[model samples]
Target: MSSDIAQPTTATGHARQYGDRALQTLLSANRALLRAEQVNALYQEMCRIIVETGGYAMAWIGIARHDPGRSVDAVAHYGDRDGYLRDLRISWADVANGRGPTGTAIRTESVQINHDFECNPRMEPWRERARSHGYRSSLSIPLRDERAVFGALTLYAREPDAFDGAELELLNQLAEDLSHGVRHLRLRQEHAHNARLLRRSLFATIEALTVALEKKDPFTAGHQRRVSRLSARIARELGVSDFDIEGIRIAAQLHDVGMIQVPSELLVKTGPLTPDDYDLIRRHARAGFDILEPIDFPWPVAEMVHQHHERIDGGGYPRGLRGERILLGARIIAVADTAVAMNTAKPYRETPGPDATLQALRDGRGTAYDPAVVDACLHLLRDLREAA
Candidate 1:
């Protein structure tokens, strides 16, 4: 087997060389931590950095598991060109395999160094494997979590007495940084999982509210769903982002939720209503806002519901929010709501054909509706007609 028997003439010369490499390893590892997004990716990068930057023959990370056998599993490794770890097994228990640098460092929660693997009795179990891989020295540093040591970062060197003094100190710091980075990434992943769960629960609650409104008003049975579809299409046509379009669609679905507070008879009345009836009908926007304002939604859902009826020129609604004052989602919902209502058969008004609806949108494009949203809606309607 090939061996690294060459040595520096002076101890000071070896220290200087090792110090420079260790400093580089520490710097590169710190930078990796800043950009690391996944634990496995970080582990792999650390092993690679240890070998490439510190000039080690091989490097690996082992996670200590409290399984039935108290095993230490090699999670990530680099530079084992001959696959020296293919049959390697280790444990933290006081066994033959566990007596090595890796297991002993983790077991004692400290650094374990073997300056000359050939002369070390602990290396007896895997001496031939180490020699075959050209590993004459090794260092293992325990990686800790908040509770206790969770893993070990082990580095193998081609030359004996490769790690010492300043070099070992810097490598220990690198291990500590890696442990903290792993813990942080896991916590972030868990928080994101919780956020997804919370979003699902919130959507469930919104669906139930929509169902209640549908039960109360027959006119609104399928109106919200249609408006939501058209609003999403219009938003997409206008180059709105997918995430914003999702919020727009959800707001459209619940835009008329305030109608739940309106009298059922008023909704179904075929006869001309007095000014008082019309005024009460207009209050639904404010009522919907009040219903949703207290809930913490990730999107501006409540404001969109409140301002869906508001005109761009300050001519409509519970609040006369003019021009840019209206939320973009609210503006999109307005056009969608208008298009759906005009084409649908209403008890008090005749159903306007697609041609008439298109004219009305053209007539009010910039005055009552956002010009861009109206254009998108017209484009969608024309496509639907042509497809039909």
Candidate 2:
């Protein structure tokens, strides 16, 4: 028999050709779906394809909140940059549930189009925004997984009736592929967030242990708490993000963790320390770093502990690190530690008030600390004292 079989009759051959093309399109879309690891990039590519091939003027991806009843938020957009900027500010408040084309598509879990928004009752509320941006027609397709609607993809055009039957069919298929990709992306993000939460929880437990150790020494019972407050305040003044501030605060609480290894009598001694006792006391910073190094913290807690004793002029601590080599977090902790230690009543000395503490930091600025961090600390101390 010949390796090539005879061609089928006309009708059968046409059906077979159509089936082959559909399979090829699906395979191409599946390849694109694998790039969904970066959702923003995937959405941008989807919008580009729609606008270039399907004649859309603008494209947007709005993701539904986990609560099915709530309206969606626009997570990505691609189009005429100026036009999108003008009309993209519509919040959930402006999109009535099951009313506008986008909302209706999401609610019905299907693709929808408004060829003339001016006459479409469902799109009336959003017509003005679209009209102002020169949009005459639009298509809204719901993105879904097996369970239910995940969100909607909206395409806008300057000309009315821009999306004909062929364009609509292509967009519908694209929306289905995008839905699966988006669902996968969401699951990955959720997993990453949960892992971060677990790491933070373990870090918190370590901080609590340090706090417990501090409490054992009556003189420093609340020392860690005060230092943490001061460090967080300084971080805020420096415009650090909330995430970094949380890390800095937790690290501050455990900065003196190595002190636990020192004898209790040495920690509470009223008189000046002897050579041997002083050497033991100085070892706490490195000891603290060693203790924290084994734990998997969400941030660089071990490095922060190690550098907390370092100074700006290369005169401080076990390694004598200077300048920017030290982490900003450690520098901030150093300033807070110094201020709190000076202001609080130690076993050997009386406590200075906030004013004296601020003056002490100012005197040591640049030599003992980072000037910017010290200035921020001084400002924070003044504000906190006034508030108190």
Candidate 3:
């Protein structure tokens, strides 16, 4: 819980400094996994944790780069790195620089350790760089997920022969923890991306259907759009969760979509519809339900559309879904639909304005409309008026 996690003051002497450093490093990685939101930030913090908590002189992470060059790019570093991280062009190719622990770890997908960095033959090329930075012993451990190796974490110690069997074992666990954190972040990002693409496809599909309906009934060109907006507001006012609110909006957007099956002349008819014509007009609800049932929507969009015209008193048509039998989404859409329709001019009647619409809603609070939905609609009307 403490912010200063680098040093845990348990003992007074050299024992506390070196003996407990590995435990602190492991704890630091666990803390970073909780705090860091993404992979790049996680790696950067891991490098810092090794230097500050693990008692290492320096630490850096190198991710494998393909395509233009089969080389390693030092993505994260902590401690004294004037231009060393940028200048060190280590590669997986069988060459002088490639033989070092960093390149070797990446190529072999295994941990590479140099207990004597100054005397090792493979350390000859970058010996001066290592010596100037006070690094005498080094550890290059591959950071890997279950499937494959992604990168390497290179740690430098101040003393020679720093990494014995116990130290190596502890550091390997730290590497594994870092791999798990990175993999979790990548998976989260992939899932978010996929969800966004799926939503886009759903929106486009619904919009196409809405447009087709609007073209058939030119008088109601943007009626569906308005209903969708109102439904979303009403749902939000009712304290609906985000996912269910989207379903309400989508269903409301295509609420009258069954009208596309009716004759075009009947839709634009300015006179009162005959009994036979009214029956045909009402059939659109079932038609819309049939149309939407095949599409795999995450929400119950089809059922909401089918029941949107139903009354709480069981008098309204298309299934006469009464009381609790009607979906909550349909109830919210019902209030939104009536509010919008009453306030807007129709081919058969003049516009009643918002005040008249609210009056009608208040009069029919329970019998015709869901009382909860009506109250939410009333609050929204007041909010809209205040905003205006």
Best by lDDT: 1
- Model 2 C-alpha lDDT per residue in residues 9-92, reported as the tens digit of each score: 223334444344334544555677886677777877777666654445888888777453565777777776765544333323
Write one digit per residue (lDDT tens) for candidate 1, span 1-388.
1122333233677888998899999999999999999999999999999999889989999999999878999999999778987878899988887977888888888788787768777677788888877888888899999999999998998888887778888898999899999999999999999999998998898898889998987766788888898999999999999999999989999999898899999988998888999998999999999999998987899999999999999998988989999999999999888888877777787777677778888998999999999988888888444212
lDDT of 1 at 298: 70
* Residue pairs of candidate 3 with colliding backbone atoms: none
Candidate 2's TM-score: 0.56
lDDT of 3 at 244: 92
Reference-based lDDT, residue 88, model 2? 38
lDDT of 3 at 172: 84
Task: Arrange candidates, best lDDT first.
Answer: 1, 3, 2
Better model by lDDT, 1 or 2? 1
Q: Against the hidden true structure, what lDDT does model 3 obtain?
A: 0.82
Q: Report lDDT (CA) for all predictions.
A: 0.87, 0.75, 0.82
Q: Sum up the clashes in candidate 1.
A: 0
TM-score of 3: 0.90
CA RMSD per model (angstroms):
3.9, 12.0, 5.7
Worst-scoring 10-residue span by lDDT in model 3: 1-10
How many residue pairs clash (N, CA or C atoms closer than 3 angstroms) in each of the candidate models, in the order given?
0, 0, 0
